[model samples]
Target: MAVLRTLLGQALRTTRLSQERTLREVSSAARVSLGYLSEVERGQKEASSELLASICRALGVRLSDVLRDVSETLSVIEPEPAPVLVPVAVPAMAGPGTTAAELRSVRRPVRDVVAAA
Candidate 1:
C-alpha cells in the first residue's frame, strides 16, 4: 500500500530494523496492544503524542530523533524540493507566567505590486 512508504511508516520500520526489534517487544515496552502497534508501525493508524513518546522510550531513543529521521527521509522523498530550515535555539518566552494571549498568532500584512505600463 501507499502508506507503507510514507515518512512515518518508514521511520517506524527503520527504527524497528535498526534495533533488530520485534513488534511484540515494542508493544510490551510501550504498554500498547501488539495488533494496534502493528497498525501504527505500518502507518495504518495515527498515533497520539503520548503513544509515540512511549514507543520512543521503549526503543531507547528520543521522540525528536525519530522526528528528525522522518523529516530527513521526507525531504528527499518527493519530486519537488522544499525550503530548508535550519534549527536554531529559540529562547523560550513562556515559562511560569506565560499567558494564552501571548501564544496566539497574529496575521502579517500582504504586499501586492502593480506593473507599470
Candidate 2:
C-alpha cells in the first residue's frame, strides 16, 4: 500500500529543497520546532493538516499544489490492478475436464463485468 504521509513528506522536502531553503529557515517561518519539521520532512512523523498548511505558507506555496504533486507521484507509484480470474463452466460437448486455456475468453472492463451481473 502507498503511504500517504511519506509521499506528503517527500513533496514538502522537494519543494523546500527546490527553493534552496534550509530546515531551520522553513521551521522558523512555519513556527514549528526544527526537530519536528525535520521529522516531518524525513517521513518520520505525520504532520497534521494545519501543520501542512503552515509549512506550505512558509514555503510560499499553496497546500493544494503540494497535494497535487503528491497525488501525481502516487499515481505513478501505485501498483496496477491484478488480473481478474473468473471460472467458466464448460459445456459437456467440450470435455469432462477442460482446462482454463480451453474456456471461452471473456475480456471485459471491470465496470462492464459488474454491470453484466
Candidate 3:
C-alpha cells in the first residue's frame, strides 16, 4: 500500500528541487524550522494542514496542484484488488423438470479463491 505522507513528501521535495531551492530557503520562507521541514520532506513527519499551507505558499505552488500530483502518483503505484472466485456446489444430476430457482437454492459456496492480478 502506498502511504499518503510518502507521496506528499515526494511531491514537495520534487517541487522544491525543481525550483532549485534549498531546505533553508523554503523553511525560512515558510516560517518553519529547517529540521522540521527536512523531516516532512523525508516523510518521517506528517505536516499539519496549516504547515502544509505555509509550505505550499513558500514553494509558490498551489496546494491543490501538489495534492493532485500526489494523487496521480498514488494511482499509478497502487495495486488493484484481487478478484475473488467462489466455488459453488451443484448436484451431479438434476431432473429435467428442475427449475433454475431450485438449482440456485441447492447451490452453496464451498470455498473462496482469491486470484491475484
Best by TM-score: 2
For each candidate, give its TM-score against the true structure: 0.60, 0.70, 0.69
lDDT of 3 by residue, 1-117 (tens): 878887888889999999999999999999999999999988899999899999999999999999988999888989976654353555767689778987786544333322221
Residue 63 lDDT, candidate 1, scale 0-100: 88
> Tens-digit lDDT track for model 2 on 1-117?
668988888889999999999999999999999999999988889999999999999999999999999999999989988766555444556666766556655444565566777
Candidate 3 lDDT for residue 49:
84
* Residue 116 displacement (Å), model 3: 26
Best by lDDT: 2
Clashing pairs in 2: none
Candidate 1, residue 29: the lDDT equals 94
Residue 75 in model 1: lDDT: 61
- Per-candidate alpha-carbon RMSD to the true structure: 15.0, 4.3, 7.8
Q: Candidate 1 vs. truth: CA RMSD?
A: 15.0
lDDT of each: 0.71, 0.86, 0.85
lDDT of 1 by residue, 14-84 (tens): 78889999989988999999998888877888888899899889989898998887777666754564444
lDDT of 1: 0.71
**Which ranking of candidates, highest TM-score first?**
2, 3, 1
What does the lDDT read for residue 43 in candidate 3? 89
**Candidate 2 runs further than 4 Å off:** 83-110, 113-117
* Best-to-worst ranking by lDDT: 2, 3, 1
